[model samples]
Target: MKLHELHINDFKFFSQVEGDSPLLKIDGNHLLVYGENGSGKSTIYWALYTLLECSFKKSDDEVRKYFKKTGDESLVNIHATGTNNTYVKTILKDALGNPKTYRVSRKSSDMSIRANTDIRESNMASDFINYRVLFKLHSSKHSNKNNLWNWFLEEVFPYVKKSSDPCLIEFEALKEGPTKFLDLNGNQLFPTASLQDAPSDEEKIFYRNYRDYKQKWVTWHFWLETFLTNITTRANDLINHDFKYNFKIGLNIIKKFPTFQATDDKIKWTDPEIIISITEYEGIQNPAIKKPHTFLNEAKWSAIGLSLRFAILETRLYTADLKILVIDDMILSLDMCNRDVLLDIILNNYVNDYQIILLTHDRFFYELAKSKIAQNGIANWKYLEMFEDSSGTFPKPLIIEKTNQISKVWQLYHGKEFSMAANCLRKATEKLCNAYLSRQERINVNYSVKNLHEMLEAFRTKGMANGLNQNNLIKLIEYKNRILNPSSHYDIETPLFETELKRAIETIEALSIEANINV
Candidate 1:
C-alpha cells in the first residue's frame, strides 16, 4: 500500500479559506519536496508522522490533544479560531486497487486505531529520519564516550524483534520488567518466606525463580550481542561500498545486571548502553580509534550515524502493506559528493521498496536531484516546492506542485480546459527548444524575434545533427502544424479536439525525453 493523497486543513502553516488550500495528489508515486527554511517543509513531515503516531495511541484524548485549539503539542494554526477545525487526512491504496481513507481529527479519534491492524502495521513498517535524529547519534561531549542507550530504547528497540521468536520485543520486554521472576506456567512468582524458615517446596521454588531471573538477563545480553554484531557488519559494508570510506564501525553492548529487592516488589537496574568505536584502515593495517566523535569530522560522523540507523531500519522492516521513507534534510552536513552518493543509494536501492518522501531546503541539491531523476527516466515521481506566503494576516505555505510547464499542461488538460492546455503545451515546446539553443550557444540577437516556426526549424536542424530522435522531431512538426501554428500565430478559430490536444501534449513530453531536456 501507498499514500494516495494528503490533505491538510488549519494545521500549522496550512490555512483553509473557503477550500482554497490545495491537496497534495500523490497518486501513489514518490514525492520530492524543496522548500526554503521556515517555508512549512517540515510541516509535511510532521503531518505524516503525527497521523501514523495516532494509530499507536490507546485513548481518543491522546489523539485529540494534538488538534485542539490549546495545548503545548497542538499543531493548530495560530490564526485559527475555535470555529476552525484542524485535521489531517490521507488516502492509502494497495495493489488490489482499492483506496482506504484514514483521518485524524478532534472527533475522528473515536473511530479507534487499536482495532485496525493495517494502520498499526504500517506505522511499524515505515521509517522517519531527520537531521535531529542524526544529531542524536554523535552529539556526545569529547571527554564522554558515545553511548546510544536512550536513543536505542526510544527509537530502535521498539521496531526490532528477536529472530527466535517474532512476538518477543526488546522494548516491550524491558518496559514490563522481564527480569522479574516468573513460574513455569508464565505466572509471576514471589518468595513467601526466608530460606531458613520456609517449607522445602517453597524454598525450592524460590531458588528456581532466582536462577530463572538471572538467566533472563543472560538471554537478553546474548540477543543484544547478536544484534550489535549484525549491525556492525552491515554498517561497515555500507561505509566501505556506498560511502567509499576507509573506516569500520565497532559496537559493544554494556550489559547492566538487574538487582532484586528482598520484598520482591521493586526491581531496579540501569539501562544497557552501546559504546561505539572506530577502526581506520591504512594500506591493510588497522588503527584503533577510541574516541570517534572527537577524532572524526562532522561529515564522517554523520555518515556513521546514518549508516547505523539505516542498518537498524533494514532489520526492522518485516511485513506491512504501506512502507514510507520520509527524510527531512538529513544530509545537510555532508559535502556534495557524499550527498549525491546518498541520493543515489536512496534512488537506486530503496525507491522500489518504499514510497519515498524526500524534503530538502537546498536549491542546488534540489535541482541536481531532479535532473538525476529525469535522466534516470523515473516517470512515477512528483517534484514540489514550498514557500512561506505572508500576503494574509498570518503566514501560510504557498506550495507549488506543478512548477514545470509539462506538468502544468497535464493539470489543465485533466481539468477539461483545452485552450489553456494548448497554450501551456506550446510554451513547454518553446522552452524545450530555447534550452537546446542556449546549451549549444547558437542564439544570436535575431533569436529574440523568431517565432514558433523558426524555432522548430532551427531545433530540428541542430537537434538531428546532435543525435536527437528524428521520429519525435517529425511528431513535433506535425503537432505544431495541426494545433500550435494556426491557433497561436494566425489567431484562427481552430476547434481543439481532446484527443488531438492530448496527443500533442504527449508528443512534447516525448520530445523532451528524446532531446534530454531538463531545467
Candidate 2:
C-alpha cells in the first residue's frame, strides 16, 4: 500500500480561494519535489506529517488547533476569513488497488481516524526526516552530553511495542500511568483527581495497577537497553558501508527509573536520556569522546545523525505495507561527495522498501537527482516544482507538474518559441527512435550517434517491416526536413514557420502512433 493523493485546503500557502494551488496527485509513485526557499515546499511536508500524526492524538483539538485561526502555529492561510473548510486529506491505495480516504478538519471528529487500522500502521511505518530532526541529534553543548530523551518520547516511544503485550504501545501505557487507569474492558477503575476517597476494592485495584505499571517500566527499560545496543551496531554498519566514515556511534539509553510518592496518587519517574558518544575515531578504538558535537565537523555530525536515525527506523520495523520516507533538505550540511553518497544510499537501499518523497530547495541537486533517476531507469517517479506566486494578498504556492521530453516540446511550442520547440522536437524524436530501436534490437542503443536523419531512415527501414505505413513514413521525413532540422531555421514572425512547426508536432504524433511509441 502507498499514498495515492494528498489534498489541502486553506492550509498555509494553499488557499482554495486564491486559485493557485492544485490537488497534489501522488498516483502511487515516488515523488521528487523542488521548491525554492519561501516557495511553500515545506507546507507539503507539514501537511502529510500533521495528517498522519492526528491518528495518535488524544483529542481532535490536538490536530484541529493547527488549522484554527487563533494559534501561532495555525496552518490556515493568514488571509482566509475563517477555518471552516481548512483541512488536509490523504487517499491511500491498499494492496488490491483500492483507495482508503482519511481526512482531518476543524469541524470534524477524529474518532474514526483513531479507530483506523491502516492509518495506525501507516503512522508507525512512516518516518519524517528533515534538517531540524538531524540537527536535534547533536544540538547540545559540548560540555553536556547529547540527550535525546524528549525526542524519543515524542517520536520513537509511541511506536515501540510493550514486551508483555505487543499490541500495547509504550507511549499510551506510560502516559496514563497507574492513576486514572482504564481496565481491559474500557472501564475507569478510579477517578483522575485523587483516589484518596475511593473504596477499599478500588484502592486495591490502584495498588495492583501501580505494580503492573512498574513491571512494564522495568520491561521497557530492558528492551530499550537491548534496542539501543542493537541500533548502535546497525548505525556503525551504515557508517562504515554507506557513509564510508571511520568513527562509530556509541549509544547508551539511561532508564527512567520509576519512583513512587504515596500521597500524590500517581507514579513518577526520572527523565530518560539517550546519551550519544563517539568512538573509534581515525583507526583509534574506544576513544573517550564525550562531546562529539564540539569535536567532529558538521559533515561528520550529519553523517552520524543520519545513520543513527536510519538505523533506528530499521530496527523499529523491518518492513511495513504502507511505509513512506519523506526527506526534506536533509543533506544541507554535507558536501557534494557526501550528498551523492547519501543519494546513492537512498536510491539503492530504501527505494524499493519505501515510497520515497524527496524534497529539496537546491536546483542543482534536484536536477542531479532527476538525472540519476533517469539513468537508473526508475519508471514510477514523478517530478514537481513549487513556486511562490505573490500576486495576491499573500504568497500562494504555484505547483507545476514536470514531465518528460515530448512534454517539453508542447511547453516550448505553447510559449511561442518555435526554434527552441523544433530543437526539443528533434531531441524527442531521437529519444523515441532510440526507444523503438533498443526494444527491437534487444540492445542499448547509443543516442550520441543516432542523428535525426539516420534514425528516421533506420526507423523507416525497420518500422516498415513491423507494419508502419509507407505514406506516414514519407510524411515524417518531409516534416523532419521542413521543420525539425536545425539548419532550416525560420523567423518566429513568419506564418509559414508556425504552420510547419504545428505540422512537425502532428507528424511526431503520427510517427509515435505508427511506431507504437510514446516520446
Candidate 3:
C-alpha cells in the first residue's frame, strides 16, 4: 500500500490541516522529511504511527496519555476552543490502485476515537521503528523481552498455531497428557499387577486412561525435542544472517560474531528463552558473552538491534506487499560514515520492497541523503521541509534541486535571490572551515560555535600554522566581512548588485579549492 496523503485535525500541533493542505503529500512510497528539533517532526511521526498501527483502538485515557501535553491529557490543539473534534485521516492506494480512506476521530465527549476498520491483527505496526525503541533493544531492557518473543512467534512461526498437521497434533496430545492420568480427586492412579489379574470396572477404566496418557506423553516427548530443535535451528540461522549482514555493512564493531541458543530446563518445554552468546573457537577465543547489552558498545548494540528488527521484517509471516518502514531519527548515535552505510543498506535492500518514511533532524545527513536518493534514481520519493507556525507544523515540498552546498549557493545567486544566496554562502564557508580544521587535526578548534565569523577566525588561527593557504584564508575572511556578514545580519537600503554577488561567490569557490574541498 502507498500512502498518498495524510490529514490531521486538532491533533497535537495540527489544528486543522486537510484537503490540499495535507500534512504530508506522498509521492510514490518514499518520503524524506527534514525538520529542526521541536518543530513537530515527531508529531507527524506519531501521527502516521497512530494511523497505520490502528492505535485509535486504545482507550481514551491511554491515547490521551500518549498524546498528552504538559502533563495533561489533551491531544487537541492548545489553540483549539471547546468541543472541537480531533482526528487523523489517511488515504492509501492498494496494489491494484484502489484508494481507501481511513479516519480516526474523537469528539470532546468521547474518550477514544473510532476507526473504520480493525487492524489490531495486522503486523504492520511492528515495522514502526525509532531511536527510543532501538535504545531499548540496545540496552536489553526487560520490558522489551515479551515484545521480542511475540515478534518472533507471530512473524516467524505464524503458521505453527493454525496447523493441525501430525506434528502439531502430537504436540497437543503431549500438552494434554498430564491431565489424563489424574483421578477425579486429582490423585494419581496406578495400573494392576498383571494383565491376567481381574480388575474392577473403575480400576479397568483407570488402567485404560493411564495407558493412553503414558502413550501420549511418550509421543509428546518425541515431538518436543524435534520442535525445540527446529526452533533452535531457525533462531541460529536468523542470528547468523543478522550478524553477517551487519558486519558486512560496517555496523558491527565486535571481534566475534554472536550466535543464538534456545535454552530451558530439560523437562520445561512450555517456556524457553533465547540466549545470544559469542561464538567461540579454540582456547584463545573471546569470552562467551550472553548479554550483548553488557559486553557490546553502544554502536555495536545499536547495530544488533537494527539487524534484529530488519531480520524480523524480512521473515514476516505475510508477504511484503503492504509493508511500511518508519525510521525516525535512528542514527543520532552513529557517526556520519556509519550513517551513510546504514542508508545504503536500507535503500538497496528495503526501499523498493517496502514503503519508507525516513525522518531526520540532522541537516547534513538530510542533504547527503537527498542527494543519495536522487542518485539512486528513485522517482517516487518526495523531499519535504517541515516547520511550525502559529497554525501548527506544516510540510512543504522542497523543490530546489541543488544537491551540494556550493551548488545551492550558486543556484540562489543566479536566480537573483541575493539574500538567500548570502545565507547559503555563510553556511558553505562554515562547512568548509569545519572540514579544514578537522582535517588539520586541530583539537582546540571549537566545533560548537554557531557564528560564521568566529568559526572562520578560529579556523584561521589554528590552521595558519598548519598547511592552510594564507592567501585564500585572508580572501575568505575579507569577503565575509565585506558582503556575507552584512547581507545576513542587517538590512541595506540598496540590494547587492549581480557583480558584487558574483565576486563573493568567486572568493568562496577559490577558498574551497585551496582548502581541497569540492564545491
Best candidate according to TM-score? 1
lDDT at 52, model 2 = 73
Q: Model 3, 55-128: lDDT tens per residue?
A: 33435555545344435655666765635556776677776878766665553333323332233323332366
lDDT per residue, candidate 1, 1-519, as tens digits? 888889888888777644523368888999999888988898889888888778767688888888898989899888899587787878888878798887778876435653467777777778888877566655553447668676676556655656523223443454344334444556664432243354555345566445555576688788789898998899888888898888887888887776554545656767778887765564344466657778888777777777877887787655777899899998776787778887887888788888999999998988888988988887789888776665457777766676678886776666555665677688898898888875434454755556787788888888789888787787788888766754553432244477778888887888787778852
Number of the top-ranking candidate, with lDDT as the measure? 1
Cα lDDT tens digits, model 2, 278-326, are: 7788898889776777888877777776776787668546344578889
lDDT of 1: 0.74
RMSD of each: 9.2, 8.5, 12.2
Candidates 2 and 3, the one with greater lDDT: 2
The stretch of ten residues in a row with the least summed lDDT in candidate 1 is 164-173
Off by over 4 Å in 1: 17-22, 108-110, 141-143, 154-217, 263-267, 283-286, 403-519
Q: Decide which is better by lDDT, 1 or 3.
A: 1
**Clashing residue pairs in candidate 3, if any?**
60-111
Weakest lDDT window of 10 consecutive positions for candidate 2: 159-168
Sorted by TM-score (best first), the order is 1, 2, 3
Candidate 3 Cα outliers beyond 4 Å, as residue runs? 18-20, 55-74, 94-98, 107-126, 140-274, 280-287, 319-322, 390-422, 425-483, 486-519
Of 1 and 2, the candidate ranking higher by lDDT? 1
